[model samples]
Target: MEGFPEKGIKMGNMTIKDIAKKCGVGVSTVSRAMNNHPDINPKTKELIMKTIEEFNYVPNNSARNLKRIQSKAIAVLVKGIGNTFFSDIVSGLERECQKKNYSCILQHVEEQEDELDIALHIIKEKKLQGLIFLGGSFSHPKEKMEQLEVPYVLSTIRTAGENCEQYAAVSVDDFKESYKMTEYLLQLGHERIAILTAPKEDESIGKLRLMGYAQALKDKKIPVQEELIGYMDAKKDRYSFQTGYKLTKELLKKTDFTALYATSDTLAIGACRALKEAGISVPDECSVAGFDGMEAGEFYIPSITTIRQPVEKIAKATAELLFDMIKGKEVPRQLVFEGELLERESTAFSSCHESVK
Candidate 1:
């Protein structure tokens, strides 16, 4: 194996990747060896540790050493406060923190606020051991992330390309789940399906879900209609019931469709109310579907058809991962959970198809 510099010499520029390269092992293997994961050969682990010691390299500035301050506190930064879909996930995270005997701080972040900036300030103010970002568009420059001294996890947050691998994340594949919903509607013989989604410039989950909807239509030989796509007003909208109702009302003016798909269950409920006021019967006159299997959707007048995300499971995994990262036991990785498509009373076979029958 290629050896690094002599002991007692500080290699300021050395990194974990560099050490892995010298050992001729994969980055994950190097991580496992450093963390004593028990799966690696004892001889290999010793060699890796020796190499690390020789270069005087520190992984993320010595995880255990940073825990010396003894602050058993963590913070959860939640964006889009009014969205009910995040409630369970937040609750689960808090419970996990409690089980670990750590204090959990929940902070709401506004639409325009920078979560990272807030986190940096809070980390200093509260002396947090670690943190988790609950919901937001997390697309920050590496330099900005490097400023975060403690380990953190992204829970139900959407990150841009290449940037995802740089940190640990727990979320569903938005594009795939959206495509599944769209395809379900399509399979029910619904054409000209309308979609209420994020703003036109959204680059996070909104963009992915929108792309999925479009792809499903194209595959079914249906051309995507511009008027059928409802874009939320990001500056003024909070992904709340009012936003969905307002968007649906506006959509009602310009076009007609057999089915309407909302990106969230909260939006789906609002859309149903708008359709009801407009003298439209859900799943009879028109079909409706939504994402996020929130509790309100189940108890609504017409139970909403949605994509059920495993929030509790996701929360447990996120806590485990963040704590593991803090203890120098794991590396940053993306964990995608599958979303189940729940067919409920809100959506049915398109009436247009029934007319032909």
Candidate 2:
């Protein structure tokens, strides 16, 4: 009766007994009403349900399952599988799980795979206590989420087309952060800036960042040039160095710009390689910037400028939030972290439109 209130269970934590008193019925009658017992009056059951909803009485459904002794475990579902940035996050989650004495199961969800369907299957087959979803554009409906009964956390994801009540999330605000990076580039006097980003079809982080980039240019009265934007090749990895390198190489042949910004550090590094090959000195002939402050950026010949997301903190917080929800002590919520803009060697001040000279 922990959830039950005192003084006929009316004032504090609500119990079935309180509900029964409010309905002017016996405890068995209230139980019957809640359970949809055939013996209960239909109108009486409907009244009880309304009261339950009004009072927000949630029954502990896990009590029965908790009795079954199973090794505690949680699942981490990664979309885009092997992306290096996610590797750090996944490793962090694994370590956190170890500290909590819980097992971590990682499932790499393919770009085309239906993640929710896969998650439902895993939850039942593995009997996981909780779940952590990494990467991917989330588009599941409330129904789809209900199917995933266990509490789950979405890390580094931008969810669309659904109510957020179904899950908790940990990530930087993609739009504002992207805008910050773009504005930084603008402030450097780079007028004709080009962006190497994800495809037109991406509805996730890529889309948000792209919009932010566009907004930054607009605020500065610079018309967003379609030719300056390089949408990722459908055939290439969206966040890969190869994609960045190829796009920059392609851009060099077609347009002129003083600055180039890639959505990820890996892509930015690739851009640097392409620039070096073309005899264009970084921050001298062409400035560059990237998102995600990966360690590789720090060591690159011309250390890359980037927005550093707090990966370790986000990862640990993700696990803690999910575990708290699993224990019925917390509710689903979104937590956005601030990113640090590190102006490194790869970018420099340039007053004139250098073009691809």
RMSD values, in order shown: 13.0, 13.2
Residue-by-residue lDDT tens digits, candidate 2, 1-357:
444443434444567777877788888887787767899889989888888877777654345456432438899999866568999999999999998868899998887787898899999888898999887767777777887888898898866445754568898988899999999998888889999988776766888899999999999999999999989854456687888899999999998888999999999999999999999999898999999999999999899999999999999899999889988999989889999999999998764844522
lDDT of each: 0.88, 0.85
Poorest 10 consecutive residues of model 1 by lDDT?
Answer: 61-70
Best candidate per TM-score, number?
A: 1
TM per prediction: 0.79, 0.77
TM-score of 2: 0.77
Best by lDDT: 1
User: Candidate 1, residues 1-357: lDDT per residue as tens digits?
Assistant: 235666676687787888888888888888999767999989888889998888887776435466643577889999987898888998999999998877889999999899999999999999988989976666788899999999999888777555667888888999999999999999898997999998886767888899999999999999999999999987887678998899999999999999999999988999999999999999898889999899999999899999999999899999999999978999889899999999999999988787643
